[model samples]
Target: MKRKVFLSTTFKSLLFLLFSFIYTLLPLQAQQLYQPAEQLGELFEQVQLQSVFPDSKTFPDATPLASPDEILQAYQQQKDQPGFDLRTFVMNNFEMPPQPAADFRSDTSLTVIQHIEQLWPVLTRQPGNDAGSLIPLPNAYVVPGGRFREIYYWDSFFTMLGLQASGETELIQNMVDNFTHLINTTGHIPNGNRTYYLSRSQPPFYALMLRVLAQQKGKEILTNYAPALKKEYDFWMEGANTLNAANPAHRRVVRLPDGSILNRYWDDKPEPRPESYLEDVHLAQESGRNPEELYRHIRAAAESGWDFSSRWFSDANSLGTIHTTDIIPVDLNALLFHTEMTLAQMAEMQGNKAEAKRYEQRAKERQKALLKYAWNEADDFFYDYDFVKGTTTNIPTLAAVFPLYFCMAKRKHASAVAQKIEADFLKPGGVVTTLNRTGQQWDSPNGWAPLQWMTIQALRNYKHTRLADTIARNWTRRNIEVYQATGKLVEKYNVEDLTLEAGGGEYPNQDGFGWTNGVLLKLLTLHPELLQTTEQEAVLQR
Candidate 1:
């Protein structure tokens, strides 16, 4: 029996609009066994769908049948055959689709820096006339390769940092333009520019992206991109406008007992995600939780960009306990704070006095609410606030760095956070993503490029330069070590155990990494004076 929570009709109608946008959730991965429906439109249902598509190695990401016309054709041709094997039929009709090939090989002769510079050009993709699920972007952008072919929301920001280092300002400009285009079209940037990711968004990093551009282009970027930034801010602040003391929370906005508002990760989606179709279905069956609730929570985690991590689980070790929508991530609120402040800055720059004041007040309110709810003085570390549970969670992740990263933390708080990171977060290779190694890609051992950048930046923000340099060095060394060995950079690294490749979550480790190259480039550029030139030369010589 599932417990029901009644919601107001107005809120229900709002979610209905959000849901209508997410229609394409088809099973695309190979090896990932997904039982589909009998037929969705012209497509085969899960039953026949499983038999039709092969494994991940063979079929990847909303593939084998790219269109409704193709699906209709496949069923029409195979319906009469008594022994219709969907896989064989697909092969017969469509050309044997092969994954994109790389031109560069594992060349130990090249320095890791040189190898990365080589891969940057390869990772940078222009979609151009490329059709299908590799959704065409208006601008050229870097992709974290392997399975990913589309531009992601937050990934591009960190990736842009490296592009800046590579003197690729044009690429960064294109990335911002692409995001601006997305905001103009969709009201906010989706997690990635995919039809399936249409229902949700990743971490609200648009403001940060603008900041990166502003670093190069000056204050003009704020006014120039103000409309897109305003659209994004409005998207996150949608329900908050209508919210009042009588009804404080709606959608992403949550009004606490004291009438203070903060945002929570949310997705209007309530189904098995097409990309992770089988996994979502299997988890729903096994978890025994309300399937719709679980789906929403899972989707919310994706919005949080710490997808499938222990931080979202009610029980630290179990995927079944995932309740992502229940907690308010420190990072999400911090990003929103940045967004609000950025909006205010832009408004003031444009001489919009009334709008500037409104945004500034909003930022102040959020900062106060965040400190009240998210800060844990007892632990001397920031923890995600469990809005549903009514306390700070025990789980401590790199999200703690956000306050310092955004300059929200007080000197005392910043001092404590820097110490905490130095003591627990840092590893031999880099900072482990989280203390928990729950076999999720976002969990321990998997040190992602974005988090590494945030952590290093935060350390430097509080004048912990030596510690920041250490982290930057370790993370850069790990990235270089991996590149030297595989002749490639990956989406994430196993910072905890450098000997093993990073593993966990839905897919295999990805290479031609967008953020990896970007962060390395930016870090190297930022601390060129601190370079271990002899050590790097020794590694390359071998």
Candidate 2:
């Protein structure tokens, strides 16, 4: 027994020493990783502004063929010379990111399920050595495809749902471990693995991912990720203790009028996003608002995963009027509520009574805050609270379903929400994202896969099985019809107009979609009747 204890202690000591030595060896600049935009500085701006690659994100994702210093020195020496070719220089110095598998021909006879299964291997990225701007994971992960060449924070959770259905347990665990590594190294998982995304994180789906893994593996999986769960919760609630009446908002944490705390989406940095640099700069220039404040709001909207939605805009018609930081989002708070509840359960299982109680109390307070700030009694649905304006923003959307998704809504409220969905949100194809046809993709005429899954499950939670089944059938049918036409699954669908492709975003609607595939597969598994033989036969000519 003594020998075993001694060996364990020696092993831990060695690990500590090795880590410390490696930490010391990395210089401050090397330790603080930079994206290509920051590394190449003026050169990056020129490349983007001149439309060298057309897509602003392209240059940022490109891997440098040599060190940034060498490239910059060459630029300095050659940029001043007459007839200096910028495009040729960039092509020579950087290896452009690979485009999505646009050329991969699909087997026409295979059904959507078979296509998804085959695409799994294609979507699955193996672990690689770190490349320029790409933060390499220790374990393999599934990317959401088409310009999104990195593992996104929230997208992986939904992607795992499909993985679970496919019986790819190892891949799911590998992705979970990758997120754990991210939390340990970066304090929180960023929007994705890119260095430019370091300032912001997407919805706090880490706890939800852990819940899925635990459901499959057992409660023991929770204990294994207890530290990560706590770290994620801490990152969102970082400034809760500092918030006071005088300064009610701090970063992501917002202290309400009733003294209850909730969260809002926020990004640490105020600069224009490197991925959307040109668009952000143009918007900021056009808005005539404080450029920093506008940039932060845009970044916060990005953090919401419903980027450019009317839900974040003060004026529902205009993206320029976005005031995301001032709004306490119902979906964000519900996600945090689930995170707290998960942490409490994990703590209780670990036999830590005090920590468990602390989390429980936090969850209760947040639930109360959600009811107080977000629930609209007259409307009988939840809406985001504009804390700065001290009123409900009153933009109705699929985000209202989040409270039910977490089982946090009152039974009466759930019934009212369901009625609202049937009356306004539900559509022929599925449920439209919002009632307004504002050109933003998260608005009317569009139905995203993640929102569909959430709404269907939320309806099921409230025992609205018929509505849930209706949604499931419609959504899955729409997915099949589109697949039959295009031979591909995509990021979002035009649920209001089945004949048209989903549109409205900085980029075109992406194919090889992660969440769409995951949600559709899971829905089909739940309601296999949705996959009619007639639907499969329609794609035979492809």
Best by TM-score: 2
TM-score of each: 0.88, 0.94
Tally clashing residue pairs in candidate 2.
0
Residue-level lDDT for 217 in candidate 2: 67
lDDT of 2 by residue, 36-93 (tens): 8777989988887788877889989988898898998899999999999999999999
Give the lDDT of residue 218 in candidate 1: 66
Best by lDDT: 2
Question: Which parts of model 2 have CA positions greater than 4 angstroms off?
Answer: 1-32, 100-102, 533-542
| Model 1 per-residue lDDT tens digits across residues 1-542 | 12234444335324532432232132223213222221233343442237354332233244434444566666777667899766565555444333543565757677656766777777777656444344456668877777776788998888888777766666777788777766756667899876667778889988888888778666665677777788888888788767776776677888777778899988887976766766787899999989999999999998888887899988888898998888988999999999999999999999999999999999999999998899998988888999877999879899999999999989999999888888988898889888897899998878988999999988888899988988888888888777766778888899988899999997888877788888887887777743465355555777
- Against the reference, the lDDT scores of all candidates come to 0.76, 0.86
Query: Candidate 2, after superposition: displacement of residue 243 in Å?
Result: 1.0
